[model samples]
Target: MPSITRRRTANVGRPTSAETDILAATQRLLVNGANFTELGVQQVCTEAGVARSTFYSHFRDKIDLLVRLATELMTSSFDVTSAWKPSEGVERLADAFLQVVKVYREHAAVRRALTEVATYDATVRDFWSQELNQFTDWTIAVLRAEQDAGRTPADLDPVSATRLVVMGGERALVDHVTAGDPHADGAFARELALTWWYGVYRRPAHHGERSPS
Candidate 1:
């Protein structure tokens, strides 16, 4: 394990096994309730059982490591979301969000680190913004499909509604995870499903219709 960790170094364009141990070790520490902001590289090195040079070569600093892990977590949640298109119906949509919640809850430590570090780190913040925007963009496409099928309102602006729904859901879900409440999951999922379904996709077209200029 030490030989593998020492030999595999990260590259600008590719991934390497050098980070595997360090990532797992950091995750273990975080899972054990280690404070991310207060955690040091040396501690990670010790837990990972790699040299300091190995850790540094794989990550610029502690935040970088956390950010990478957070990035993976965000990607995982997004993947769960992408599995359900808007046309899949409210039940499936809610199920998708539930899966997303599960993913976040599974990596609760990394989720906490992501939110905390993003407050001051531009790299993590930018990555976060981009991930949300990607979701927004993808949802817009799905909304258009529903509109084209006469399921959603004819006059709905997919861009605006998608932004509101996707970003708003993101904030709500983040809060749900941070609060560490499992009882709220079902209601929250159903609420999200209802909002996206009736609030946007299934609303009467006349409700949001506009007059001609």
Candidate 2:
């Protein structure tokens, strides 16, 4: 008679090193535009150098794995901009704003692919929407702080104003990625950000105050 070892139930729920490999491989494949439908479980398992059973052990299916990968990408990107702080005035804001646009533009390929995939996919769409809202809220908070410090125009409403700024930045990036010109788009985005900052946030001169050259 052959002797068999039974697996523990407690150990069944945990992700193995193989699952981590599959997740990382899935992200790389997706970023490279690998056809998810054509690349079935066996393909992914082979790509990750894992057994088929190991792949199914961690994720319900490819979509589940893809969603997790997308979430990871968004979380990582958010971390990059989470520490943003606007300096003394509009000019400083423009500089910080350009840094963000530049980073987005550099990651244009991955961003575009994920955004396009999100359009028809409910899971991806929800993930993107939640991330966008979080980012917009952060922007609103920064603008509110600027307003309180009197660096931003007192008349501007932070909530509505921040939404407008977010929309503008979103549209700019969408257009840039769609156009296939990340460099030009980045430059234009920076200029547009500067324009919006100066137009909406700059304080008006007091009565009898001469304009500085």
Q: Give Cα-based local distance difference scores for all models.
A: 0.76, 0.61
Best by TM-score: 1
Model 2: per-residue Cα lDDT over 1-213, one tens digit each? 111112111234445687679876765665577765456788778879988888767776665665555555555546655654554444444455556566565555456556666667775566567777887888778778878997787788878876776777676656765574655644564565555556555555442223322
Q: Model 1 misses residue 63 by how many Å?
A: 3.0
lDDT, residue 95, model 1? 82
| Candidate 1 deviant stretches above 4 angstroms | 1-18, 203-213
Estimate, for each residue in 151-210, the C-alpha lDDT of model 1 and write its tens digit. 777899999888888888877877888795798887788777778877778654354432
Please report the candidate that would top lDDT against the real structure. Answer: 1
Clashing pairs in 2: none
Shift in Å, residue 129, candidate 2? 1.0
As a TM-score, model 2 comes out at 0.68
Clashes of 1: 0
